[model samples]
Target: MTNSHEKLRMMMIIALFAALIGIFSQLIIPLPLVPITGQTLAIGLAATILGARYGTYSVILYLFIGATGVPVYAQMTGGLGKLFGPTGGFLFSFVISAFIIGFILEKTRFNISMAFVANIVGMIINLTIGTIWLKLFASLTWEAAFLGGFAPFIIGGIIKAFLAAWIGILIRSRLESAKMLPKKATIS
Candidate 1:
């Protein structure tokens, strides 16, 4: 069983990851449809490195921060209004993505290849949900959603996934070395 100290540390790490991602999200990465935010990258890394419980919390915290009037969301928008806006789906999808990524990583062994697959799969799931949610809000057809939102971001998504997975794997390795991460807890 994990000790209280370890659990506390886990919570701290989850909060830290959320904050880190929030900070990165504030820094705009130019894109056609929606300017890039570090949410995806951070979510991927958080999910992979921190495990599912903390990973999901990190994403939930991010949404909570945005909903609570923090101007850390994409386009510097915030509050409950943002959650109802067109981008709301994407924001909500982040939580799902984080959960899936963490679950996949926890279930499998942590290897660069497996991490890569998990990141890609998890991101795709989030993207699908976000795009579909946007469609419902805007009355967009699937073709339109795919073309308008998903298509434009494919390449960028791949790049972000690569970086997130790479960084996560590296961080996981370091944590394991320091005995902060369990050796046998992770398979492969």
Candidate 2:
């Protein structure tokens, strides 16, 4: 494809992934302070398949959509209020985690093993930032933040990490073969 066509295709894919993240966000297991959602899994998949530039773009787009009052967040909630709420840290962390996850794959190799490691690291980043934000935003103690924000998500994060690795690699390989995505990520 020509440069313009390629750029358009990439943009469309980014938008699609952003929508996917929103859809996944609705898969919520509610908790007192937070919810376990498929948002992370979708984030991992986006990073694994799209790499740093596009994956992060997708996440930003998702956040922008939600912040604009789109019901795209967990439990079908959205708006700027959600973005600044106690769980806002988790939403913000998605950008960083997606970038790092894709960056790791770009730096190493876009394979299941590497993707798994990257996803785990991304999960940790999400938990850390979310916990800290919970403490500060909610004015809770550090222990409360850790218990409510970090501890509750550990097992789910691991499962999602593994699933993202396995499924993301499979889908990415297929897309690469079909020329839907480049074998290696590029900013363009």
As a whole number from 0 to 100, the lDDT of residue 105 in candidate 1 is 82
TM-score, every prediction: 0.89, 0.97
Give the best candidate by TM-score: 2
Q: What's the lDDT for all of these models?
A: 0.79, 0.95
**Top lDDT prediction, candidate number:** 2
lDDT of 1 by residue, 1-188 (tens): 47776777667777798888788787676755556677788889988887776788888988898899988787677899889876678888888888888778888867778788888988788778878887888788888877766777778788888888888989988987887754344333
| Each prediction's RMSD to truth | 2.6, 1.2
For model 2, the local distance difference test gives: 0.95
Poorest 10 consecutive residues by lDDT, candidate 2? 179-188
lDDT of 2 at 39: 100
As a TM-score, model 1 comes out at 0.89
Candidate 2 displacement at residue 183 in angstroms: 5.8
